[model samples]
Target chain A: MSTAQRRLDIEEVGDVTVARFIDKKILDETNIQIIGNQMFGLVDEDGRKRIVLDFTNVEYLSSAALGKLITMDKKVKAAKGKLRLCCIRPEIYEVFEITRLNKIFDIKKTQEEALEGF
Target chain B: MRAGLVEVGSLVPFQLKRWDPQPCGEPRRPAEPEKSPLEFAQEMTDREQFEIFIPSETAAGQAVQDRIIQRLEARGFTDRDVFGIRLSLEEALVNAIKHGNGMDPSKSVRVCCQIDTETVVVEIEDEGDGFQPEEVPDPTAEENLERPCGRGIMLMRAFMTRVEYSDHGKCVTLEKRRSVEGE
Candidate 1:
């Protein structure tokens, strides 16, 4: 329902909501939906469109999770806000590379880098 | 009048009766043993194969993918190979459950995995009406870059060396050759 109730660990930095994925593996369909909903809630319900997704703790994620990221990116942009992703593991970053999502999203090396100018 | 065992290759054939129940008077033979498609596929492989059937419910695809990844890892696959297999298998299962079965809890998705010395093959099948894989838009295309859907099939093709669809697109088979170092 709410972003706080979901598995994602959300924190606010300035006008941006930095959400950290706490799950080791975010491959399951249910977890994908939960995380997606949490991100969507931030943009739609809470009206906090500027966001940062931290993937430092995530070990693995499915293509469905990638799809969710794309969705969130579009949603945040449509709301006149920005969404940045940072701290993605190398292996996980390969998925984005393969899908060419790295070019579509604003991915940075760290949270501070992603938060800058956001 | 007499019954005799007819061995067909390694399969044990049923004894046929000469007595005919139909107008054709053909020898009454037991129906061929029904073999699941997965069983037939496994029979063709010389190494061990793994398979599981899961409902088209939330998170079921991930559970199956996790089990498959574990098996691949134990078989001495490299991390990159295992990661590719895991990602491809997850995409296939998700497609089977979401696109093929439409996330209907009553429907089920079947996954069969076989690992040989050279390659790992996985087949995923669903119960719903199939779709045309060719019609899926390219996610990498500039026009479609922001689209959330249509990326699963692309990722599956990217991660696996070979990807094929059959049974009217209801079934997808993914194959990844094990790295030379893994062998």
Candidate 2:
């Protein structure tokens, strides 16, 4: 359940844990589980609440990944933490828009923008 | 030694040179070969269909999406169309493996993808007793927005031009039209 072995680049910036997904295609269940477990570890184990996911490199993701994001969002909210996403490619963002998840998550144009409010 | 020609249906004739003796008391019947998913695929001049059988496990859906995208791109599909196809295909495959097949690795999800110039069609069938798609709650509803279970079907319907389910909800067919610029 440790985030250390995940395929995400994790960095701490002013109490905000910014995790950038390194994979271009997060389209499967395994990757989704990995991200979900890692994010859960960050919240439950590490107790780091404020998090930003940088999707600059992610070109595509399946609904399974979206489901994981929703789980993460709910966990963070339950713990009084914040979860935001930034740098989503338009194609991937369209999936969010179609499913109306764009309204649920605090999506920003850049990682700096996401970090600003935290 | 005996030699004979065995012709099975439309398949090529098999020349049997010699028959080996059974190792045990009674002759053991040969186990039936499992039918491949590709055997279900239909080929046409205008469109080509590919069927793959994948285990009900994590990350298996991604491989189906990749192959469909490659075919779509090769057929001159736009990036927008490819994106839509990928998203819808992923959703269908996930539903087949997780919801339909219950993530049992012993169960195999069958996927058939047919592509041509104007549209891409995909069908995913699973081994589980299917549920009614109409019964799935609306994810866009305010109360349901936070819920995660029903959004995959919504995404597939939203992205695909048409979505149909048959075989008591065990099979879903999705279709998406190719996007042309300036239209």
Candidate 3:
């Protein structure tokens, strides 16, 4: 979904919190880097809003990146916000399904749809 | 089984094979059976021998995998062989980069994959201080069922003949004995 370096950004959608991760795979060493797990946003309240992760640029994700998503999901749910993944790449989606994590996450085709979901 | 050379950046799990499915990692693969996991690593040099540097970063795992796969394929590596190698190498490289270098993209990680006359050898080194292998929790053990830190190590060990840590634990050397062609 993404087309550049591994990165993260923040945005707001209809009261929803969106954290955009550059599709760059955060390798343990070279090729990429992992800043930390809390790279995603943490909202403090629950409304007709959502906490979305824009995977539009993320092309490959390792377990480390997956770990960050898990940690972020926990924080989002704790704050009563839903963790929604947007524009996930098909290959990475294969990885998620292989790891059986597809069942635990809210994967959406677009940001607008995820926001509308709530 | 003949004169062949491949790289994984180069990848660590150099799954040496000729035919078998789980061929690369098995301890007792036949001489050019369905596959093989031959090793060819030397320990005279420092841990730096186990490092690598990839300049351009690509987020596409398939592309990354394809790059390595095609390189190996030209040298006679099959799809199954690549899969096993990818799994083991990914685990080792991931650890070497993350735990060893602390995930610093600026600092390159070292990886040495040797597929020579009789074995498949993979050595990985990071630019960070190493830990005592003993101190790391064992994922296969009952106590570490849910922890994710050491599962890769366990999996790597399973897929390779041996997994050893050095450079005070920051460098890892993985190997699988090589098999000859129809010996």
Candidate 4:
């Protein structure tokens, strides 16, 4: 898919790649698939070491999206990289809390915090 | 089950059967009341109920979800309620389409939604061999936390007030009682 169909806005801060999701609702399967491919490419293709996913614009996230994030985390780990998530809204955080994913993923309150100590 | 209320727009007769387990662990059935059918229908005027049948395609599921969200917004459900419902709907519908029907284009999924001032009920049925919910490994377990799949059912149970399965698990019913604004 072309950049026009990209769902994530990628920005590099030093060695870390900060990806911001463009869609407020990450519920569609096709969009989620594209996002998964794009995110995986960050570690698999671009060979980035540190990454932060800023969910500042996201209002809704489905379990499918969470699945992709989990895969991304694994990919980053396999590549000897780090992944952090920040700026998730309260409701979405509750989703993480409910699934006990909060314990596995390094989540921060803001992008600044997620970008720190890398 | 609410007494004397015939489900307004359930396309399948089985959809009318309430599969939600009660506190006593029994399948709850709607109690018959002395009121006439017209009276029961009148009582349900405040509720909106509809059904959508779609091919086992994620796009069709998304359309149904969008329609349900529109209905929830029109019914004045709060943002929190909408978020939970939308998330649960996505999980449930995707499960029906992807897992239940196994993405077989020939298979179909049926979705039924009923919305009222204080509650929303949705049921999705798919054509496939059903599996036991208990058989699903807990996604939150330490051994499974990093696993990519199996969280959809967990999320649905978390977001919905009640999650029930019937017809050998081919059908799932999701219910959410709207939270009062001040609460």
Candidate 5:
């Protein structure tokens, strides 16, 4: 899921939304509380919830981790917001490839370009 | 669940198994059941058990997968079945890496794939405190918005019929049913 570990900074350029999460994963279950609120209470002033995930330090990904992404993407889509991922390791890329998830998410080569695109 | 618990994807018979059975005076059979590398496996990573040890890396996992696939191929496993088995094995190793060892390369995970006439069993053990099932976030739920995790269990459960957590939560034993229609 999107760790409270480091939402680093979030700002929207045009219709794009960008946020960086640093050293999450082990932040414990406390993030569940923070994430639950975002689906509704955390809506932006413009009312669109497009989120671009930047994973620079995150190394490994479990299915559980991927599952959370799916759940969040659902919320964003339901609210007419686009959820995308940027800055992922090649190893993690293999996971998406094996599961054919690469076709499912908006995976970008770089965070800057991803943010700029949205 | 009963039949699905032990599904076998492909059914390739063993052709490469070293055939040296004509030695040592009729091959003295062990009086008891032959024990595998590790006896008891962990239920979950949390209360995970100690089992067979193997390097915790991508290649190591692949090698084990190849061996299993080879053996199954020899036994006449269809290509589709083999792919299913591969998916099961991949999930097991992945679970070991994430839940069992917390994705620490320094640590090694244990794997045991036991096959019999009626069923095929796969076990994966990792080195970590293990986690509880309740700890898993529900991806299908709306509350887990924008998060990533918990899909492995769903995929594995979908690929294989029966998946069990042992060693508290460190190890997982996955069993798929075999089709009686011999190829």
Candidate 6:
């Protein structure tokens, strides 16, 4: 998907591809579906290995969106790549904590930190 | 039209009293009750209420969700409160539209919400054969943490003050107390 059509603002820091979510509320199903496809295409199609998801723009996220992230995580792992998440606001971090996804994904406090060691 | 009204304040499951579907199948907003000017002014910002029925499509569901979020913001719900409510509302509505009703256009979902100074209550009911909540696996378990599907119920429980399922899980009632400044 083109950057205009994708819900993410994609950037590259060194070898890591930093994809920032553009939507503050990632609740709508259609948007989530589009976002998921775009994110998945980075690995399945683009074959980019090191990935960092920047959540600085996201204010609200639903479980369906999280499902997409989980699938993305699995895809990255299957491709023998790495994925890191950064800039998640406290409320969203609490969501990760509540669902115990905090344990499954490597989370960082900043984009600089997420890009390191990748 | 079924005459049984589903009250938003109640935890018990209540059947919706059927009314004529709104034109174009838009979400039906309940008519405002008659109130004197003074009473209306006094209660204008103190409480907000809506009773909506939408078809079983996620796109149709967004209108109902956006209205409730706007109501919460208008009533001065803290950002955190809105975040959780917004998340929970999405999960609940999707559960109703997808899991409960199977996205059957013939099925409908009812959302009744009441927002006041101290509390926000929302009741969502779907027209379908309900499932047992207990049958859902614990998503937080070590083996299940990576699973994406079952976390909605858990997040709703974590975010809301009270989450209750009734009428064989066809109806879910969500409540949240407004967060205090220091507490």
Which pairs clash in the backbone of model 2? none
Candidate 2 residue A4 C-alpha distance from true site, Å: 7.2
Model 6 Cα lDDT, one tens digit per residue, A1-118: 5654768889988788999999988887788989999999999999998999999999888999989999999999999999999999999999999998999999999999998888
The clash count of every prediction, one per candidate, is: 0, 0, 29, 0, 61, 1
In candidate 6 chain B, where is summed lDDT lowest over 10 consecutive residues?
B1-10
Q: How would you encode candidate 3's per-residue C-alpha lDDT over A1-118 as one tens digit per residue?
A: 1353335676766677777875464444333334343353144322323677788876545555555566666666766767788788676676566555676688988888877847
Q: Is candidate 1 or candidate 2 better by DockQ?
A: 1
Ranking by TM-score: 4, 6, 2, 1, 3, 5
- Candidate scoring better on TM-score of 1 and 2: 2
Query: RMSD of candidate 3 to the true fold?
Result: 10.2
Model 5, A1-118: lDDT tens digits are: 3443433456666766666554433122234334434433334434668778777666544454555556666777888877778888775676666555676689987887787757
Q: What is the Cα-based TM-score of model 2?
A: 0.80
Off by over 4 Å in 5: A1-118, B1-52, B180-183
Q: Each predicted model: what fraction of the native A–B Cα contacts (within 8 Å) does it retain?
A: 0.71, 0.71, 0.04, 0.82, 0.35, 0.90
Per-residue lDDT tens digits for candidate 4, residues B99-144, read: 8999999999988887767798898999989989999999999999
Q: What is the TM-score of chain B in candidate 4?
A: 0.80
Write the number of the candidate with greater TM-score, choosing between 4 and 6.
4
DockQ, cand. 4: 0.81
Candidate 1 yields a Cα-based lDDT of 0.77
TM-score of chain B of each: 0.72, 0.73, 0.57, 0.80, 0.63, 0.75
lDDT of candidate 6 at residue B118, scale 0 to 100: 83
Q: Which docking class does model 3 fall in?
A: incorrect
Task: Please give the lDDT score for candidate 3.
Answer: 0.55
lDDT string for model 6 (B1-183, tens) is 012222222322232343222222458786567876455445544555668889999988888888888988887888888889989999999999999999999989998887778888888999989989999999988998788688899999999998888879999989999997555
DockQ of each: 0.52, 0.46, 0.11, 0.81, 0.17, 0.76
The interface root mean square deviation of candidate 3 comes to: 5.6
The numbered model that scores best in lDDT is 4
